[model samples]
Target: MRIHILGICGTFMGGVALIARELGHHVTGSDLNIYPPMSDALAASGIPVRLGYEPKNIDPKTDLVIIGNGIARHNPCVDYVLNQGMDYISGSQWMCENVLRHQHVLAVSGTHGKTTTTALLTWILETAGLTPGYLIGGVPKDFKETSRLGAGKYFVIEADEYDTAFFDKRSKFLHYRPRTLIMNNIEYDHADIFPDIEAIKKQFQYLLRCVPSNGSVIFPNSDTNIQDVLSRGCWSTQMATGDESGWYAKLLTPDGGAWECYFKGEKRALIKWHLVGNHNVQNALAAIAAADSIGVAMHDIEKAFATFSNVKRRLEIRGCVNEVTVYDDFAHHPTAIATTIDGLRKKVGEQRIIAIAQLGSNSMRMGAHGDALSFSFQAADQVHVLRPEDKSWDVAAVLKPLGNKAFVHDSVADIIDVVSKAALKHDHVLIMSNKGFDGIHERLLDKLSV
Candidate 1:
């Protein structure tokens, strides 16, 4: 079958296209914004990607149109499909009918850490020789491609709570009937779609309802929001992290490079890795619990964790030059920003941690987090925020509590200058954004080189 995808450059939809191509389907896609590295990956896979949405991009031989959530109903291509009466389905729905239905799906979902946990779990399975199929939101450093169809029975998915498509209001994870579900932690996010935290929790309830009774659900006991979602009613076997009841972890060192796992208070395995932060420790715990449901031995899990390569853009060290380290991270949300900064702070310890953040995500741009965002950056010695011109919220007003510690600018160049000046020889610069912050990481390095 021939499939043409709309909004194919996004991580999720791009992964779908790769999987479709791997399954022997002729796949082509169109997106308004097409650039590397997704563009490079798709082109390397022999899949043709059109530059933008146009009625003419739809091939006469196309069997189906798989639309991504990024497309709206009024889009020209969508209107063309509707006017032509062509069959169209969402990315998640297409996967449900074609790929996920055939695999033992293991889904990792949360407001944060989904990509890393999914990558870690997939690597663990791969290291154990499971050769599991996977569709992660970002490219794992260990894999050549972001999505693949392996010979193993298990399929790992970085399940999202976001709505499936413009036509479907259901969360994308609902289409993936997971045998092992990891609820890393939940916080109010996607303020554009969800009106409140409870609305997001309700969606989680619906996802939990889909799990079979014999399947297992793992979450952090430290997250009260997750506990509230589970309290609504849970039928599947439950595992908890940060508590001794089901599965938990203990850090062997204050630096967070090594950790020990426990299952119901019994020592399981000691894992040592380069990944930093307590959040990553919790992510590892969730992945371990999910792996256990698939009957993977603790020793194998430990081995995989020791060598696991995290997904790109999650605290990825872009470069280190002249005793200064620059990191690229996808930390648009308040909690994610806090966690990423905290991890870096722990690693460097009193060494200056300079942060370059942008109001990229819709929630952050609208100032949905308000003063909460200011507190998230307390660990940093100084923060430079890229405040876009169109935002109605007063970025500086909200960050006023930080006083001289915070600097807000409407220009990317200004933020880069501030970051470069504030950063010293031993400092660590964390560049945080969900979208590309005007390629600030490399640009900062160039400016600092002078």
Candidate 2:
């Protein structure tokens, strides 16, 4: 099959492309302003990616067009395909039909930690010799690629709640039909598509309906939002984390670098890994439960946890210059921002944390999290926010509660200049964003080296 994907640079769409290629399909794609590591991955796969969404980019011999959620109606490529009467399908639907239908899908879904949890579960399965096929939203340090066609019958995917495509408005996870589902915590996010928290929960409620009766649903006990979603209806066996009644983690270290895994009020294993944060501990507990449901032994899960390297950009250290370290993280939502900062604070102790953040996600740009943003950075000694070009919301005013501790900059250059000057030895600079942030990580490292 010859397939051409629209908005192919997106992490999900890119993963689809890779899996399609691995299946012996001739795949090509087009997107605007392409950047790595998706671009890098696509290039390595020998998949030709055309820049921009020009109508001419679509090959006449293309057998099918797989549209990404980011590509909407009236795009030149979309119109071209429609006018030409070309066959089209959304990426999620195609994934469902082509790959997921044949495998025992273990999907990790939530607003945050989906990527990490999916990667962790995949790693655990792989270590157990399952060699589970997997699709992660981001690059994992433990895996060579974001998606793969594993030899095993199990397929682990990072399930997202975002709308499928321009044509398919349903949440992407609705099509996954996971046998084992992990709902990590959920809060209001993707404000562009979702009107409110209830709207997001409705999508999750629908997702639960897709899980088979024999499957298992793992979640945290303390999350009222998840509890509310489950209250609507659920058929799968439930496994709760964060409490003694279900799978739980007894934190052995303040930073959550070490923990005792417990199931049904008994010690299962002691997990000690490089990853920190209570959020991560929760993610690990969920993964352990899901892996256990699949019959992976506790000792194997412990071994995998010890060797897990984590996904890229989740508090990954980019470089250390003159004893000043720079870390890259993919934290956009208010909850994610707070947890990430808190994790680093616990790990670094009293060392100065210079948090550089960009309001890159649609929700942040629309000021949906404006109120909560004020308290998200309390763990950091200093906060630097990159003010988006959109003036609809006042970034500085939203962060005014932090007073002198927080600084808002209008440009990447201005932020780099200010942050480089302010950073001192033993300082940990954490750059947080869902997007590339104009390659600020490398540019700031260059400035810090001077």
TM-score for each predicted model, relative to the true structure: 0.98, 0.99
Clashing pairs in 1: none
lDDT of 1 at 447: 85
Q: Supply the global lDDT for candidate 2.
A: 0.94
lDDT of each: 0.90, 0.94
lDDT by residue (185-255, candidate 2, tens digit) is 88999999999999999999999999999999999999999999999999999999999989988888999
Q: Report the poorest 10 consecutive residues by lDDT, candidate 1.
A: 386-395
Per-residue error for 160 in candidate 2, Å, reads 0.5
What does candidate 1's lDDT look like per residue over 187-276, in tens digits?
998889999999999999999999989999999988999999999999999888888887777888876899888988899989999899
Clashes of each: 0, 0
